[model samples]
Target: MRRRNQVRQSVAVSAALLAALFVLPLLVVAPFRTALFGRETPVDETEGQPFVSGQLDGESALRVLDGETVLEMDLGEYLLGVVRAEMPASFHPEALKAQAVAARTYTLYKLQTGGNHGDAADICTNPTCCQAYIGEERARANWGENAGAYEKKIEEAVAGTDGQVILYGGVPILAVFHSSSAGLTRAAGEVW
Candidate 1:
């Protein structure tokens, strides 16, 4: 009977140690996650106000590299194209709005960081390099019968979230996003 009791205690202790091995890291890391990843600033701190970083204001023109040519266009116009290309027009308006904010924040971050193209432009049209973009004509051609409705939908999404951006530490974050995750997504730290 005493031997059975000792075995039960040993099993309990081993189970506890095994559990601790998994739980302890989460407990220790949870409190520091925000500190390590940076937290979003409170909305009250910046509510109703457009984020202006350095000389990059909401109305500032953006220089984009489309193929070998450089084109300068309004920030809103650029985001319209980015939203049209980066996300499907069939998505919900709210989702498109979120994408707009992320794309805007990313564009601002690139501008602040001196983007990959250096001197050539603030951003590029390549999805791999920066973000994908499709002009109104291309988007219309692709939409076919849904052109008018899709255009209106995309325009509303872009215009509705105009000047809004996701900010961290009072600055725009990189705001990377993907269209699909291939059934599973990995944490940023795991990939980077």
Candidate 2:
């Protein structure tokens, strides 16, 4: 029937338009997002950064949950806060431990390399962020502990200090996008 054909055409057009609205913008935006994050991806590649800006980065900012402003926490503080005091017994202890280590390690790299002082605006970093931005070749070389071996030919960056870190500004050793199999935030000291 003509009605059926019209319906099919309507659905087809709707799908086409939806694809354009969604996929077209992504095509334009994804590379831009990578550039902003100090990374790049070919269209042929499957992986990519989803959002561009540091402020409205959506799930990327979820690591700093309920955070309207930045918090500066060092590794010693983080270790004492998250690892020594606050981890939950319900979670897989190894995974949680790994996250804690990653969070502390990455924070140090960020603080040392992002700038020499605490006054600059926060950089775009999260668990999924590339290791190059943290500006540490040492983190790449320390894969047994840092776990950045998957990264190929990491970009070189200047190391400014031995005590580089802040809770949100630091980089994580294990760089998966999602948080964990148990889905929980670390205790206040761990991340704050």
Candidate 3:
């Protein structure tokens, strides 16, 4: 009887230890999900998937707004208007009609990048590679007409818009949200 009790206790202890080892991974996975979402959140099943976090929001998504009428738009075209709107008014149709390089000083896509840091004309070493567009944080020029509180609102939400903006290869692409009247698009999405 004593031997049987010892064996039973030993088995229980081993089972408990095994269960803890397995559950340890579940605990670790918890933080990964938390980091992805930033918090525990329930998603709205009626709308769509809930966006979990900020970094994932800007990963390749877009936010849109309607001037007055509501409409769905392409992610690519929307982001272009943002980059353009976020740009100085110099990027307006009037200026877009002129040489893209005309307004150099305030222009977001200036031909020269200014000084490397109080040195020489900040010419790009590989303009053909990156197309040499420079901004302190891309540009305030990149934010656009629609105002969104969170980057997640730009992504998995905002199913409707006046327009939208998308990111490709870590670059912004803006396109037209033509609700029978088209908006903006670009050749390169980022450069043009």
Candidate 4:
């Protein structure tokens, strides 16, 4: 009788220890979920999945405002769209290359400085605000027969200068450009 009681007690102790091994961790960790994992930002699931473009390639993504909608795309692909919208495809390749670098720099600068489009967007399509962005369909419609060639040119310019950005004081600089400036560029303080 004494031996049977000892065995039963041993079994009870083992079972309690096993249960604590699983339950205790969950109990201790549940309260810290918000602190450790970040608060969930509300998403507009009604809008469906956001549009994605280009090769993706595991690069960091940017959230852009496409008119009323928010679009997410890879950095290089975003630059391609910017270069297409901001510069003429008929321009010399070197000119396009310069524009690509400037656009990329400007984008990086905005990202680092915290974008103005609230937390929902990193940039917008307004030329007056962030930068102009030409969607693939609009660009195709505008270019007509030359759409294929023009798109390829822009892709080359972006790919050739991958990861390049303008820096001032070892940080990315806001490199801005305009359409057909009549005079040499003026300081921001002088103009704005």
Candidate 4 structure, TM-score to reference? 0.68
TM-score of 3: 0.20
Residue 161, model 3, lDDT: 23
Model with the higher TM-score, candidate 2 or 3: 2
lDDT of 3 by residue, 106-142 (tens): 1222222332222322222222322223221233224
Q: Which 10-residue window in model 2 sums to the lowest lDDT?
A: 152-161
Which candidate number maximizes lDDT? 1
Candidate 1 lDDT over 1-192, as tens digits, reads 999999999999999999999999999999999897896433232222332222233467889999999998878888888999999999998999899889989999999999999888989999999999998777776777677777777777777877888889999998999999889999899989
lDDT agreement of model 2 with the native: 0.36
Report, for every candidate in turn, its global Cα lDDT versus the true structure.
0.83, 0.36, 0.34, 0.80
Return the TM-score for each candidate structure.
0.69, 0.24, 0.20, 0.68
Question: Model 3, poorest ten-residue lDDT window?
Answer: 99-108
Per-residue accuracy of model 2 over 1-192 as CA lDDT, tens digit each: 999999999999999999899999888889788566764222222223211222211112212211244444333322322322223223454544454445445544553465222453333332234221232232333333322322211110011112322345334332222334486656546754
lDDT of 4 by residue, 105-185 (tens): 899889889978889899988998999988766786788767667777777777777777778899988797889778777
Q: Lowest-scoring 10 consecutive residues by lDDT in candidate 4?
A: 43-52
Winner by TM-score: 1
